[model samples]
Target: MADLTFTKSTGLLAWPAAGGQWSARSGPFGLGALPSGVYAVGRNEVTDYTTSICAAFQDGTGNGFFVPIYPGFSTTRGSIGGRLGIHPDGNVPGTAGCIGITEHDASSFHDAISNTPANVSLTIEVR
Candidate 1:
């Protein structure tokens, strides 16, 4: 199993939660499901794109953070297409090939990942 997992069939982005089996953020990925495989998550979140408020993107729903996503050593893909990341959906309807937290639970989820110890690496598996 993967430490963090996203299921393309249902568009569910999930990770283990305290006292629970897992936690997830589900929503539509506009472009399509990112290639199924394991990906590394950046330790810190960045607002460079989300807060940019580029009318062409977000449609006025971006004001959060997203962590950079990369291919992991155990990934299933030879190469991932374009840039991949995950962020809060926050009233937005879809994403550009990235995972979006649509259940309005991104705040907590973001905090959890952000607070992870710097030495600890994060990886996500997309199925």
Candidate 2:
């Protein structure tokens, strides 16, 4: 399985095996930064925006953090059941509590990991 690392300090998600990296913009006011730890990428699903793909961040105990985009609406911390996931979107407003990237980057990220079997481990380190 391929391993992915996200550094909160730089808002960058790195996939060494893929030989590339992408900028991941976290929530405004630091509300979107994921807790530094190891997590698993759960089932692949479509985002609320209906134009991108996403998956859940599992805490290794059946709990999931799903990231959803509200577009023009403001997003608050824990608004969506404290669920956060990786999705496609720019580092702009309305992403107050989710990690997002440009649509192009999102597609690249999705393609890199989407084929991985479920329960693939992904480590996120917040510094």
Candidate 3:
């Protein structure tokens, strides 16, 4: 699995790299600034969202990146939470509850976590 950190304010997805440094990519998350301290995403297994608005992404995955956020929904998000994932914001303005990566780097982001052979689960902290 991969350990990642996402900054909601800036829509930056960051992760530790081979050395002691961190690598990151920027994009948009959520249709608007929903709220902070929403919830942590325990995501595993990156999949391609073929039906997504950005499904046209030319990533090797053949579509857009779609990693299901664990718990499926957030209890921290009031009474009813929404479906969430990590995908590329290709065709639209922004996302609903999912974090979006730029279309250009969707594949790299997909490989970054999907290719790792260390852990069983991927946990991402949204700051």
Candidate 4:
């Protein structure tokens, strides 16, 4: 079976009014169902100042997978790296490094985030 994990790995938590799962800011958000396999999401929650966002997964001891940052939201062939990766351009108004999707596997990456009260949520799936 395929498992999906959502995470809010940065900036501010953009949630709804009633308080529920999180979503991305403005701009183009990526959406897709990942391949059937084990994956993990990680990010540093925004507190005071200074923050870095990255997503990676390790299947086994030696096998490690690193998420790539898609440039210009281009889905063209012969790009930088293989495999579908999420691409973030710019958020509402004028913000950078916001959440966005690229591959079909990243459809649920924002489901774990909460925007309202400002809270980060991380979801993980094994097998």
- Best lDDT goes to which candidate? 1
* lDDT against the true structure, each candidate: 0.59, 0.49, 0.53, 0.28
Question: 57, model 1: CA deviation in Å?
Answer: 8.7
Q: Candidate 2 residues 67-112, lDDT tens each?
A: 3322222344345465565655442332445565533435556556
- The 10-residue segment of model 3 with minimum total lDDT is 18-27
Tens digits of per-residue lDDT for model 4 on 69-112? 22222334214224333233222221122233322232233333
Writing each residue's lDDT as its tens digit, candidate 3 over 1-127 gives 3466667666677767611222233233433443444344444456644545345233334466566564323444323455555666555546665666654546666666666663555566666
* Order of the predicted models by TM-score, top scorer first: 1, 3, 2, 4
Query: How many clashing residue pairs, candidate 2?
Result: 6
Q: By TM-score, who's the top model here? A: 1
Question: Per-residue lDDT for 17 in model 1?
Answer: 51
State TM-scores per candidate.
0.67, 0.57, 0.62, 0.21
Clashing pairs in 1: none
| Model 3 deviation from the true structure expressed as Cα RMSD, one decimal place | 5.2
Which regions in candidate 1 have their CA more than 4 angstroms from the true location?
17-31, 45-63, 73-82, 90-92
TM-score: model 2 vs. ground truth: 0.57
By TM-score, the better pick of 1 and 4 is 1
